[model samples]
Target: MTTTIEILNPTFARVSGQELRKAPFPRLEEGTKVRIGFLNNQKPNTQELLALVESGLREHYQVESRTFFKGDAAHPAPPEVIEELSRFADVAVLATAD
Candidate 1:
């Protein structure tokens, strides 16, 4: 009696050259408005940090920020709160004080 063994080769899909190229940075012009969102994670001194950030933004750029949304001490911000923040601001900053 005789025995035989078989081997299989692995196959891979090829990627396009365009897909491997890095994306260009977005162009920014002067006087463009910027929106900033601040979230208070119910930590101590949260207000102070927010104040500092607000002042810095005002001095540096055309910026606007909404009041800190207070989250529960034991729980994170609800979906509604997150949705509200996303709608109101372009970017958000969540803070916690030690």
Candidate 2:
């Protein structure tokens, strides 16, 4: 008697490495004020969580500015909001609080 087996994976889609684009990661230098941007998904406790993160960073680094943008919870951020954030923030932190 012969037996056959089937294998399966949980992933629904596979993305090619060539299709991915890499963004530059900016390095923070000591003694220089860093601009921080917060993108909030407007979920519960997102604002509070971002605030806590901001406070933690401030305790260790010199922050230049804190820019906050609220985006829709179910959709991607608007282009205008992204543009504004890019203009003001050197680095961005996106929050999806539960």
Cα RMSD to native, each candidate?
8.9, 3.3
- Give all candidates' CA lDDT scores: 0.71, 0.76
* The 10-residue segment with the lowest total lDDT in model 1: 23-32
lDDT of 2 by residue, 1-98 (tens): 89988778667577765766787767777656888888888787888888888888887678766555565788778888888888988888855745
TM-score of each: 0.61, 0.71
Which residue pairs clash in candidate 2?
none
lDDT of 1 by residue, 1-98 (tens): 89988766456556565557664433434445668778887667777778898887677667778865756655777888888887987667854546
For candidate 1, the per-residue lDDT at 35 reads 81
Top candidate (lDDT):
2
Error of 2 at 66 (Å): 3.6
Best by TM-score: 2
